[model samples]
Target: MKKQMKILDAQDKELMTVRKIEREGNALIIRGKIFGAMPMVAKLTPAEARAAFSLLDMKTILFLLSFLFRR
Candidate 1:
């Protein structure tokens, strides 16, 4: 399953378009484009994923959870 998402800048202009998200082996891969031209790929290991999530505060976490649940 592929879920598409967008990243907007402060002016609400699209900076990145997340084209696909998938799991390969033990890593999570995020494929996207930066500034509409540069291709970008990020791989997150299990430990990296946990560390990344740990950076989010309670309010942001709650907002994301609410957004997902509302869908």
Candidate 2:
């Protein structure tokens, strides 16, 4: 049996079906297994991806920060 996962890109685009997901310290390693071939592994952090696509609005930014940091 295999596990299924969704792979998202930097632009919030659904890239492909994630074949596997692994953790290396604080980063996530994603491997795509589509088209019967092994795709390249992409390593990223939640904060890094969010920062890369962060919005400019101060209020929205604050809201997002609060949401992310909330326990």
- In terms of lDDT, the best-performing candidate is 1
Candidate 1 lDDT tens digits, 19-63 = 988999999899999988999998989999899899999999989
lDDT of 2 at 56: 59
Worst 10-residue stretch by lDDT in candidate 2?
Answer: 33-42
RMSD of each: 2.9, 6.5
Q: Total backbone clashes of model 1?
A: 0
lDDT of 1 at 60: 93
Clashes of 2: 0
The CA lDDT at 22 in model 1 is 90
What ranges in model 2 sit over 4 Å off? 6-15, 34-38, 52-71
Models 1 onward score TM values of 0.76, 0.46
Local lDDT at 15 for model 2: 60
Candidate 2 per-residue lDDT over residues 48-70, each given as its tens digit: 87876775578776788889578
Scored by TM-score, the top model is 1
Q: Which residue pairs in candidate 1 have backbone atoms (N, alpha carbon, C) closer than 3 angstroms, thus clashing?
A: none
